[model samples]
Target: AQPQEGEIIGGKEVVPHSRPYMAYLKIKVKDRSGSKPSSCGGFLIRPDAVLSAAHCVLKVTVILGAHNINVQEWSQQRIHVTDWVIHPNYSSASLQNDIALLKLRSRARINENVTFISIPRSNEHVRVGTRCRVAGWGDTSVYGSTTDVMMEVDLKVQNETLCQQEFHDYQRLSMICVGDQNSGKSTYEGDSGGPLVCNKKAHGIVSYGPSGRLLPLVFTRVSYFVPWIRQQLRRFALQELPASPSSQ
Candidate 1:
């Protein structure tokens, strides 16, 4: 499926650089005309790894430690993606297993501004009605202007029954239903591939939403793919290592 871009709707500007784990994705997609510029959100998981939605992957430049994307902030660390691993079972139609890991060409500079976000344990679960936060630098409304600074909104996790009603094809294990339907708060275009943070741990990734920027957007659950994440991260590290020197 052609997934829509995303952003934070009805959100407030977070304290500058407060979310240390936040990653700004500058994507360039080549087409018939030429390469077009676009954006997405991701989070640092390791010194050289960023987690995001698979569909958002393209020719990506990962920016860390930036509040306003338009500015040349000193805290920013821009790096190109050398490699990436998308879930093998990701289904475009259903948006299942939308997670991806981007391997940076070099390790991120760890400091006061840039850091990694924790992930939920393999068996951990976020209860329904739990309030969580999602952030991005996308538009504030449908066809609205994109913001300069990063924005975030607090949304409550909805029950599976309600989620099933909104989305007939909801996947209980791999996907999650988030956002408040009545509050007018949501993730809009430019926000896809961002992290859904709960209790400071990454729980979901922005995947897809309805055409109208409808409520109860779907996210790729993180906990369900913990094993895959670990495996990929380790494999990438292994590949980056130089081959063992010949023994005497």
Candidate 2:
């Protein structure tokens, strides 16, 4: 959906998290008069890697340290994108397995402000009502536009049973739901593929919308995709090393 003006529409307040580990992804698209460069939210997984929605990375120059409202002001870091691996089962229309991993040309320097978040282990269940954090550089106002600086919000977990009931057939085991229908604040567009962290660990990746016209948000559970993540990490690790002496 397109961005609109106004901070809180229908009583919802869009803001950033206090201590966010997320980064704004400024995608440099084809230069067109009247067409702004596309932007999305993402987070560091390892010093040399980034995690974002597959759809966000499709044909774009990713710039780290981007903000939500000031595209021109934010500093563009090193241009480094060796490869992008989208989940094999990703479906654009359905937003299923909509995650992607980005390998950088060089490792990102981790400081107090920039660091990787821990991924939830396989089968790790985050119970309903648990507080989880969602961060992004997406729009603060509904239909407004994406921002240059990152923002975050706190949301409560929704159980699988309720998620199934709400999403029905569209919901997959890899997805999880969060937020309160009554709460006016929740994640929005451009937040897809960002992390849903709890207890300082990434439990899910922002995937779909609020389900109904007025509901919460849905995410692809990280636990269900732990094996895939490990496999990717292993592949990346192998590629990083030099040939063994015996092989040489």
Candidate 3:
């Protein structure tokens, strides 16, 4: 049987706002008039910047914070997206360098329900079999309907050799593989651009996996892109910083 297009396999519900940095990316259809909104997951790395998958950026309307898709709550804050930055070398065909940044029109206020997550240091890499957490509001089963509440699952970093076999295009230096061979916990549809956190640091960005079964999930290795991420942040900071008054 063909695996369902999107959803988590063998995962549990997560407490609302527990993962404060998580951002819900909604793609609005301009002409569909009354069509259901399509969504993807993202994470906040800065007050005004959201890290997400490049593929999810097209026609994205807004970033919802303290979000739980199924309900309207006082904790929810919506920020319009002002712009976006995609990696220069991102490849749609190979899904390499599959990361992007969404610039918020206004900065998000930090509070208990809205915060940022730290990215792994440039030289850091979690050892194989290291446990990590991935959270999102995606489907609960293959081809199953998506959930309104968020979900989280534990996965272990897999061996490069094993991952390479499963994902023929897997590039160890640029990608990290994670999955639970025993529990079958993996991210499916609607999870792209979400964080793979280890030791309270984001080590990967949910990239892709087999469409049907929960075998090995590939992510954009955060450590490998630290330099690029820093460059973007620095550029934005410089642009937004007030210029010093020139001496008369």
Instruction: Give the best candidate by lDDT.
Output: 1
lDDT of 3 by residue, 1-248 (tens): 34333335567777767899999888865554665667888999988889998877777755555456767678777888877889999989889899998888889889998899999889689999899999987777765667877888888998998789887789999999888775656787888889999999999999888755677889999999888988887767666674843221
Candidate 1 segments exceeding 4 Å error: 1-7, 242-248
Candidate 1 lDDT, 152-203, residue by residue in tens: 9898888877778777668888888887776778887788988999988999
Q: Quick one: ranking by TM-score, best first?
A: 1, 3, 2
CA-lDDT, candidates in order: 0.86, 0.67, 0.81
In order of appearance, the predictions have TM-scores of 0.92, 0.81, 0.90
Candidate 3, clashing residue pairs? 3-212, 4-142, 4-143
Model 3: residues >4 Å from true position, as ranges?
1-7, 29-36, 242-248
Worst 10 residues of 3 by lDDT: 1-10
Q: TM-score of model 2 relative to the true fold?
A: 0.81
Model number with the top TM-score:
1
- Across residues 40-62, which tens digit of lDDT does each residue of candidate 2 receive? 66777787778777777755454
